[model samples]
Target chain A: MKKVSIKDVAKEAGVSLTTVSQVLNDKRDRFTTDTIEKVLAAKQKLGYLPNKNAQQLRGSKTKLIGVLLPNLANPFFSTMMQSMDANKESDVDLFFLTAPEEDIEAGIMHLVERGMDGLIIAQMIKNPERLNNYLTTHRIPYVVLDQSDDHGFTDIVRTHETGGGELAARHLIELGHKQLTIVQPAHLTSNMNLRMEGFKHYCQSHNVATPKVIESTLSKAGGYAAVDDIIASHSTAVFATNDEMAIGIIRGLADKGWQVPQDVSIVGFDDIDIAQYMTPALTTVAQPIETIGEVALQLIMDKLDSTLTHRDQQSIVLPSELIVRATTARANLDNS
Target chain B: MKKVSIKDVAKEAGVSLTTVSQVLNDKRDRFTTDTIEKVLAAKQKLGYLPNKNAQQLRGSKTKLIGVLLPNLANPFFSTMMQSMDANKESDVDLFFLTAPEEDIEAGIMHLVERGMDGLIIAQMIKNPERLNNYLTTHRIPYVVLDQSDDHGFTDIVRTHETGGGELAARHLIELGHKQLTIVQPAHLTSNMNLRMEGFKHYCQSHNVATPKVIESTLSKAGGYAAVDDIIASHSTAVFATNDEMAIGIIRGLADKGWQVPQDVSIVGFDDIDIAQYMTPALTTVAQPIETIGEVALQLIMDKLDSTLTHRDQQSIVLPSELIVRATTARANLDNS
Candidate 1:
C-alpha cells in the first residue's frame, strides 16, 4: 500500500499545502482552531504518517543534545551518564559520542555533521585548540567540565580538587607528619593542577615546609614507581590525585612490607566504585560526578532555549568532602 | 535564508519532483545519465541543501543500525561496543539502547519509531517471546547475541559456553579438585544452560561424583553468599557464570579466613578488561564480543540487501578460550 503524504492530507482537508505542513509541524499558532480541527480530521481519516525523520531537520530546534565523554569503561563517567538520564524532566533525545585522545577531532566532526544544537564535553586531552577551533567554526553552544582554570573561553563546571587536597593535607598535618608528597600525572590538566594547588595552599596556610611533589602516569605502574622515591625520602604520607593510582601505591607498598595507615597514610581522589571494595578502603575525596553531568545538561538546555547568552561565564564548584577510610590514620611519629 | 526544497531543485533542473528525489536517494538506475547530470548540476549550482532528516524518510533506507545491550557498566559489553566501532568498514551510524528487563519493550518500540533498519540485541532476559512479538510486528531484521540456540526464529550468534565450561572443569579437575559447584543466575537462559551442561558433562565423564549447583543473582552480593554456601558445604572449587560474580566470590573468601587459589580455586567467564587487572588476576573463558557485534551488523546488512531471507535461520557460533591467571591454582587435598 502507498504511504499517505502531506499532499493527500491537504487534498482531503481542502486546504493549501502550507496549512497541512504547519499543522503537522505543530506551528498551528498561525491558524485558527477551526482550521486545525479540519486538518486534524483529514489527517486522521487519511492515516497520515507524520515524518519524524523529516521533523528532526525541519525545525531550528531539534531537541537533541549531544554528549561527548572520554570512555564508558570508566565507571566515573558511566555513572555520570546514568545520573544525567535520571535528572531530565523534558523529553530530550541524547546522542553519546566516545573518542580517544587521538580521534577527538573526528568525534567533534561527527556531532557537528549530525547538527547537534548543544554539547557537553568532558575531555582530558592536553591542548584542545583543534577542538576549540571546530567549536568556533560550528558555533554550537556547549559547556566544559574542566579541572583547571584554563577554560576561560568556555563555560566551565569546576570540581573542588583544591578543597579535596587541603582536606587531605590538613588531616596529615594534624597528625604531625612533616615528610609528605603529592602523587599526580605529568600533564597540567585542571584535575591534577587544582589538586596540587589545594595541597600547596594547605601547606602554606599551616606554615609547614613545602611538601615534595612526585609526577607520574595516572596508572598503577606509576603509583608503584612513585613509592620508591617516597621511601627514599622518608615521606610518611602520600596524596594521590586519583583512586586507581592510590590503590596501586598500596599494592606496591604492601609488596615491600609496608603496612597502610601504619607506616604511610595514603589519600586518593574521586572515590571510585572499587575504592570502597578494596581491602584497605581508600581515604579519598568524593567528587559528585552525577551533579556535573546533570548541571551541564541543564546549562546547555538553557542556551538552546535562548534564555542564556554566555552570561558571566558561570562556574559551579561543587563541594568535595574527605572520606577517611582505613587507608589514612594517626601518623606514627617514631618512624624518624 | 529559507531552506531549499525539492520543488525548487526540480524547477531549476527542468525536471519532475520525483526525478530529482530519485537522483538524490541514489535510485539513479531508473533515470537517464543526462538527467542525472542535469539534476546534479542544478543541485550544485543552486547550493541545494537536501534536508538529511527529511531525505531519510522519503528514501528507502536510513543507513542507521540500532544496538541494544544489557548494561554499559559491565566491562564485557563496553569492550564489545568499543571494538565494534573500530571494526565498522562503512559509515553505519550506531545508536545504543540499554534494555533493563523492565523497559525492554518500551526500548524496542522507541528504536522502531526512530527508524532503525536493523537491530543487534544482547539477550540478558529469558523468554524472548515478547521481544520476538515486537520484531514480528515491525518486520525489522535483527540478530541475537549471547543467547542460546536460535530456536529457528531469528539470526543468532553465541559463544561456545559449553566448551568453555568443560575446559574450566578439566582445569580444576586436573588440579585435584573433586568437589565442585557451578554458580549462575537464578533463572536459566540458553547461554547459562549450556555452560552448566558442559560442566556437568565433564564431571560425569570423569567418573567424579555429581557436582553441586548454586543459582543466585548474577551480582557481587550473590557471589558473596554463594561463597559462604560453598565453604559450609566444603566445595573446593567454584565456577561462576561471569567475571563480576567470580570477583565477588574472591572478595567473600578473603573476608573470611580463606585465601584465593590457596583455599578455593575460582573460574569465571567473559574475561572482561578488569578481569586481568583484578588484584589476583582472574582465570576464565574469553569471548570475541566485538566480533559478535560486527557479525551482527553484517547479518543485518545482508538482510537489507535481500541476499538472505527468512527461509533459513542463520546462526554463527564463535569459539571461547581459557585464560590461565592467578585466581585458579592446584587444589590442595589436606583441607579435604
Candidate 2:
C-alpha cells in the first residue's frame, strides 16, 4: 500500500491546508464539531499516517521514542503502550526505563544521548527541579503521561483523576453507602491526590461524613492485607483506588466467608481486564488509559514534527466515568 | 553501597578465579555439589552483580539490552522484567519492543543500528529460520526467553514446559477426572506444544483417553467464551495452559451456575500473582518466570563479557512445579 499524505487528506476532507493541519493538532475547538468530525473521517478514510518528516529538528531522526513509566507492568500501562505502538506516526521503537523507582535522570540522559527525537515520562522523583532542569537544558522534546506535574514542562496528558474519584464516590453514595472506607495507596501521586479531593468534594457536597482512608499499595497483596482494617471500620462500602486492590478485597472477603455487595460492597478504579471477570465483576471508574497514551504520543510526534504552534507548556485532562458492575449494591445499614 | 566484584566473591568462596567464573556461568556440573554450594553462598554473601566488565566484546559497549516479548502486560512477564531490572549491571539498561507482533524485523534492525549490545526475544513468528538467519548473519548477540526455539540460537532460557503440562494433567487425572479438556491457545508456540505433549504422554502411559483440545486465546475472555463448549463436551476438569484462561474458566462456569472443584475443576499454568488470590484460589503449574529472566540476562551478560569458553550455543531448561490450591478437588462422579 502507498503511504497516504496530508494533501490527500486535505483534498478528501474538502478543507483548507491550514484547517486540516490545525485539526490534526487537536485544535478541534477552533472548528465546528461537524468540521472536526469531517476532517477525522476523511483522515480515517484516506488512512493518513501523519507526515512528521517535514520538520525534523534533531539531526537524522532516530525513529525511536523513549517511554519512562512508573509501575511498568500494570494492565493500564500495558494497554497504553499498545495504543502508542498502534498509533505511531511511522516505524518507531520505544526505549523503556527498566526501573522507575531508581534514578530516572540517568535513563533520560541515556535516551537523549541515543538521539531519540522525543520522550514520554511518568515517574516519581523527590528532586523534580533537577529532572526539569536536565530536560530543559538538553532541549529534549518530551511529554509526561498519566502524571500531574506543576513543572513548566512541554506537555502532559492526564486522566480526569478527580472526576474518576468523584464518580466512584457518587456511585457509592447513590447506592446509600454512608460509612465508606477509601483504600489509599502507600505511595501517593498528585493524580491520586486529585482523585481523593474529587471524592471528598462529592461526599461533602452530598452531606456524607468524611470517609476513613486506609493507606495501602495498589497491588492485590496490599488490598488483601487491608481486609481486617476494612472490616473493623464497619463500613458498608469500600472504594479502592485501583482494580488490583478491589480484586484482592473481594478475594480476601471471600476467604473470610463474606459475600461482595452483600456483606461489603466494593468499588475500584482502572477497569482492568481481570476486573470484569472477577466473581462479582468489579464496579470501577474507567480510566481512558489507551487514549491518554495515544494522545501523549501524538503530542510528542506533533512536537517533534514542529506542528505544535504554541510552545507554551500545556496539560490535557481527558474524561473518566463510573462503570457499574456486579460488585456494588445498595448499602445494608443493618449489617454495619 | 560498594560495588562487589567477582574477585571478592571468589575470595569469600575460598575458590580460584576459574572456579568462580564457572559457577557464575552455571557450569555447576564441572564442580562438586559442595563446591557449588559454597561458591553460591559466597557469591550471595559478597553480592557479586556479574561483573561483565572483565571481558567486553562490543566496540564501545552501549550497555543497552533489547527485550522483545509477546504479551506486554502479563504478571509473569512483569515479574520477569522486575527481576531483570533488579539484577541488571549498574550501567546497563533495557530497550523494550512494545508490540512484537507487528514488524519485529524492523525493530530489531533499528536496535541493531543504535548499537544495542545484545537482545532478548520472545515473540511468535511464522518462519523461525528467517529470524535466526538475520541474527546470525548480522552477528547480533541474542537469546530467546520464555518461548522455546529449536533453531540452534545462541541461548534460550525457558521453563520446563513439558513437565508443567504433565504436572497439570497428572494433578487433574489423579483427582479422578475421567473427562478432561485442555484449553490450548489458537496460536501455539513451541513451549505450549511441549506442554501438550507432556500432558498427552502422561494420559497415554496411564491408558487414559486423550483429553480433547479446545483452541482459545490464552486470555481471560477466551477462556470465558470457551465455557459453552467445555460444558457441552461434559468435561469435569479443565487444564488451561495459563492462569488467565483458568480464571476466565472459573468465572465463565460461575456465570453458568456451576462451581469450581465441586462441579468443574480447573488447573492453569504460570501461577501468576492473581492465581493464589482468586475466589477458589487457582491450582497451577508454576513457571519460575523470575529465575528464567534472571538466568537469561546472565547468559546475555556472559556472552557480552566473552565468559563462554565455547562460542557455540547454550539452552537452559529450568524446572516447573504444580502448586495444588483450592481450585481442584476430587472429581464429582455423581455430578457427571
Candidate 3:
C-alpha cells in the first residue's frame, strides 16, 4: 500500500496539487464548487490519510489541544471539559493529561512532543511564576483555570475564591454563630489558603473568634473520619471547602444523634448539582464553572488565531457567590 | 535546525546504527553498558526528536490507550479511571474519549486516526455485533465493559447486573413491599435493561406484582421531577439504578412530607463514594469498579502482549451484592 499524497489526488482529479491541498484544508473559497467536489472525491477514492506530523512541520495546525487536570474523577473538572466540548468549532481533539503527578511540567513536555497547539491547566498546585516562565520560554499558548486570583503574572480564568470565603463567613457570622469551624480536604490549596485568609481576616475585624481549620481528604471518607474531632470542638457552624466533605459531616453528625442546622449548621463550597438535592439542601458557594469553561476556550482560541500575542497577559476573575439553603440557620442561642 | 537520524547518533557514538536503534529500543541486553551509555549521550546531545510516525509504522507500540466512556462527569467512570491509573505499568498514557453521541463509532474512528493501541469501552449500550465487527475489521483490540451479560458474541467484562436487579427486588419484596417502582436513568441501558428483566422475572415467578418502570436522566434533577408521579402511583418502595437518583428521591420525598424507610424504602445502585455520606446513609448495590478496572486492564494488556487473540473471546461475569443501610426498612403495614 502506498501513502496517498496531494500529487496523487491532483493527478486523479486533473487539478493542480495546490488546489487539492487547499480544498482538503478548508481553503476552498477561492475554488469553484465543481473543482472542490472533484478534489474531495478523488481524495476519498484514493483512501488518503493525512500526515498530521508533516502538516504541523509545514506550518499547518494540528487541531490538537491538551487539558491538564489534577483529578478527572472530580466532577468539577468534567463540567469544565464538557463545556469546552460543547463550544468546539471544528474536529479539534482534546487530550486529557492526568498522571497523578504533583506538577504538570513533564506532562506539558509530552504534549509538546505530541505537537499540541495549546493547553488548558486546571486545578494547578505549582507556583504561577515558574509555570508562566516555562510556558513563555516554550512559546506554548495556555490559560490557567483556577478558582482564585492569586496568579500574579499569567493568563488565568478564575472565580472570586476569597470573596466566596468571605461570603460564607459573613453569612454564618450574621446568623449569630460564635463557635465556628472550617473543614477543608487535604492541605490548603492555593485558593483554599486565600479563602482561609479572607475568612480569618473578616472574623478578626468583626471581633469574632477565628474558626479552627481542619485539613482532610476531599472525599466523604475523610470528612467521616474527622467527625469526632469536629463534634468535640462543639462548633455551632461548619464550613467545608467542597460539597463532598460537607455531606459527610452531615452523616457523621447524624450517626452521633445530631441534626443539621437545628444542632449544627453546615456550609459547603462548589455548589455542585448534587448539593441542591441533598437532604436539607446544602448551603454552598457557587463556582461559575460554565463561565470559566467558555472564557478558557475563548482565550486559548484567541492565542491559536494569533490575535493574542505572548506579551499580552490576562488574569480575568469571575464572581463566586454564597447560596443560602436549608442547611444553615440562626445558630441556636443556647448552643452558641 | 536539522532532523537528527539514528545514523547521526551512531556516527557520534562510533557505533553501528543498528546498535543505536537496538539500545534506544527494548533490545539492550545484547549491547555493552558502555556502548549503550555512549549512544544515549549522543542521542541527547543532538536534541533528537524521534519521529513517532516512523516508529509506529515500524511496529513500535504507542504506549497510549483510549478509555471510551458514556459520561466522564459520572464519578463511577472516574473511579474506574483512577483504578486503571493505579494499575498502570511503565509509562502508558490513558486518553479519555467522550463525545455526546450515544454510539461510539465516531469516537472510535477519531481514536484510531490518532493512533490508539487499544480501547476499553465502559458502561456500553446494546448491540455488540456492530462494534465487534467494526473492531475486528480494523484489527483494533477492545473489550466491552457491560454491567450485564446480554451480549450476543464479543469480548466483555461485566458484573451480575441481572442478579443485582433481582437482589434489589428480593430485598424490597421480603420487606413486605407490594407496590414497588424501579426508577432507572434513561431508556434502560444494556445493563439496566438486564437488571430490570431479572427483577421483573423474579417477581413474576413469585406471583408478586411486577413494579412499574420509569425512564429519565441519570441525575438528581430527573429523580426530583419524578417524585410526584411515583407518590401518586402509591409506591411503598423505590429502587433507583444509581445513587444519584436515590439521593434525589430521598430529598424529594422529604419535601413531599414523607420519610425514607418510614413511608418509603429506597435502594440505589452503584454505591458511589458519597452514598454512605448521604443524610440517611443510603442502602444500595455496589458495582465492583476496582475489580472491573483491573480485569479490563488485564484484557487490554493481554491483547497488546499478543497472548490474547481475536478468536479468544471471553465473557467474564462478576457478582454484585446488596448493602442494606438506613435507607431501607420494614414496610409500614398501615401504608400497605
Candidate 4:
C-alpha cells in the first residue's frame, strides 16, 4: 500500500509530472484526449488522491460551501439538505454541521476557520447582530434561512411561516372546529412566534374561542407527551407546529382509544415526506422546502461568484399552502 | 463591521498581544484570573473568529474528523450522526458529507485533501480494495461501518445483519404466519443481502413456504408502490427491510382498505425514533444505533491518539433485537 504520487501517475501514463497534474486538475484542454485518458486510467489504477491542500495553498478556489441546520433527524431538515445537494453546482462540494441554538455561532466560526468560501445558516441565531458583525467584518458571504428576523445583516431565504400558520388555523376552522389547541415548542424562535401569532390572529378574527396553547419541545416525543393535557383541554381540534409532532399526536390519540378526525381533528405544519404516509394522512401546511433549499444555495453561489453584490441584501420569502387530508373532518358534535 | 485584529484585542484587554494570544490559546496558567477574564471578554466583544488555518500551518493538530454516510434524509443515519455529535470529544469537530454510490471515492478524497486526521466511512464502498490501499498508503487512520465485507483492510463496526433478519422471520413465524413476504431494495448491499439470506434460511429450515420477495427502492415510496404486488402475493405477513419502507407499506395498506396485523401483519427493521410513533406502533428489529455511533467515534479517537495500533484491525459486530409492537399479531387464516 504505497502512497501514489503525481510522479507515479506520470510514470504509469508515460507522461511528464506536469501533464498528470494538469489533467487531474481539469486543465485538460492543452493535452491530447488520448494522453488525458491514459493519465486518468493510471490515476485510477494507482488510487491516487490528489492533495487538495496543495492546490488550496496555491490560491485555488476550494468551491466548498458550509451548511448549518438545527438538526438532521427531522425529516423536514434532512429532505431540505437532500434537495440542496441535488441542485447545487456539480463542481461545488458541501459540508454540513448541526448547529443547535447554543452552537450556531460556534458552528459558523468553525466553518469560517476551515476557510469555507461561503455559508448557509438555517438555524436561529440568538445574537444575529454580533454574528452579522463577525461575518461582515471577515467578508464571509453567507445566507440566513428560517431565522425569526434577518436584522438586515445578510441575504435571507425562507417560507412564509406566519402565513403557513394562518392556513392551518383557517382549515381547522372551516371544519367547524371552534375549540382548538395549538401545540408548540416551549422556547419559541421568532419564526415560531410568528406562526403562533398568525394562528391566534386567524382565530380571533373568525370570532372563534381563542385557541389554547400547549408548549412542548417541537418533536414527536413532545407531541406524544402532551396528549394528557390535550385530553384535559377537551378541544375538538389541535394544530401541531410541525409534522413530526402531528404524527406523535395521532399515535397518542389512538393509544387513548380516540380516532383522528372522528373524536379529534388535527392539523400539522411542514408537510414532510412522512406526512402523506401517516395512516390518517396528515393535513398540514406545506412549505416549499425544495424551493427554499434551492434558493438559499443559489444565493450563496451568487455571492461566491460575484453575481450578486454583498451590499445589495435580498430577502426572498416563499409562500406556504394548506394541504387538506384525512386528518381533518367536520367536528363531531357528540365529541364536543 | 471593522475587522478586529489581535492588536485591538490586546488594547481592549489592556494587555500585550502576546498575553492575549496565550490566554486565547489556553496558556492561561501563567496569568491571573482577572487578566484571563479580560482577554476573554475582549475577544467576545470583538466577535473574533480565530483562523485555525494559521495554527494548522504551524503543524498544530486540527482535531477534525470527517464522517461520510449514504444519506442524512434517513432517520437511522441522522440519529446515528446525532449520537456521534453528542458523544464526540469536546475539542473534536465532525464535518459530514453524504456519499451515495457514485460519490464515495470523491467524498473520501475531498476529506483527505481537506486534511482530516481520521475518517469514519459509514457507506458501502463499491471498491474497498482500492480505497483501502489509498487510505493505508497515506497512513490515514480510518474505520468502516455497515459494509458487507471489510476485505481485511481496516477496522469495521457493524450490527449482525443476518441475525437481525432471522429475528424478524422468527417473530412472524411464532405468530403463526406462513404466507410471508419480504420487501427490500432493488440494489442490495451485502448487509441487506445477508438480512434476506437469513430470513429465507429460517423459513426453509422451519419447513414453511419460502417467503415471497418484492424489490423496490429502500424508501417509503418504494414500499407504498409495492402494495399491489404484496396483495397479489396473498401473504399474511410482511417484513420491510427498514422502518421507512415499512411505514410506506402500512400507509399503502390502509389506502387499499386493509388493516395491519388484522388483514396482514407487518414488521420492520431499524427501530428509528419515529417507529414507535407510527399509528400501529411498528414492530421492528432494533439495532444499537447510539452505541454504534459512540463506538465508531471512540475507535477513530483511539486511532488519532495512537492508543490503537494500525495493524490491529478490529471488526466489532453488535447484536440486533426485535421489538414486538402492535404491528404484528397471530396471522389471520382468512387472509391466507
| Quality of model 4 by C-alpha lDDT | 0.85
> Model 3 misses residue B84 by how many Å?
2.4
The DockQ figures for the candidates are 0.17, 0.12, 0.24, 0.30
What lDDT score is found at residue B263 in candidate 4? 95
User: What would you estimate as the lDDT of candidate 2?
Assistant: 0.78
The candidate that wins on DockQ is 4
Query: Per-residue alpha-carbon lDDT of model 2 for A140-214, expressed as tens digits?
Result: 677886653656555888888898999999999999999999998877777878888899899999999899999
As for candidate 4, its clashing pairs are: none
Each candidate's B-chain TM-score, in sequence, is 0.80, 0.79, 0.82, 0.86
Q: Write candidate 1's Cα lDDT for A1-336 as tens digits.
A: 124578888999999999999887789989999899999999877656564555565453446667777766666777676667667643566667777777766776666555566777887645667566556645567777853244566667878778888988898898788778888887766677878898888988889778888888776667877888777768888888787788778877877778888999998888866666565667888888778878888887776675454466667788888888888878787664
Identify the leading candidate in terms of TM-score: 4
Which ranges in model 4 have alpha carbons more than 4 Å from their true place?
A1-51, A307-311, B1-50, B307-311
How does candidate 3 fare on TM-score?
A: 0.83
Cα TM-score of candidate 2: 0.80
lDDT values, one for every candidate: 0.75, 0.78, 0.76, 0.85
**What are the per-residue Cα lDDT tens digits for candidate 2 across B223-314?**
99899989988888988978888888899999999998899899999988778877788899999877888998988887777545566577
TM-score, B chain, candidate 3? 0.82
Report, to 2 decimal places, the DockQ of model 1: 0.17
Instruction: State the weakest 10-residue window (summed lDDT) of model 2 chain A.
Output: A51-60
Q: What are the per-residue Cα lDDT tens digits for candidate 3 across B1-336?
A: 123566778899999979988888869999889998999899777645565654654555556678887766666777787788668775566777765556467777677656666788774545567766656545567777854234555568888988998898899889888888888866666787887887888788778898888776787777877798788878889988788888878898999999988999999988877777777888998888888888988877777776443446677888898998889998886776
Worst 10 residues of 3 chain B by lDDT: B146-155
TM-score of chain A of each: 0.78, 0.79, 0.82, 0.86
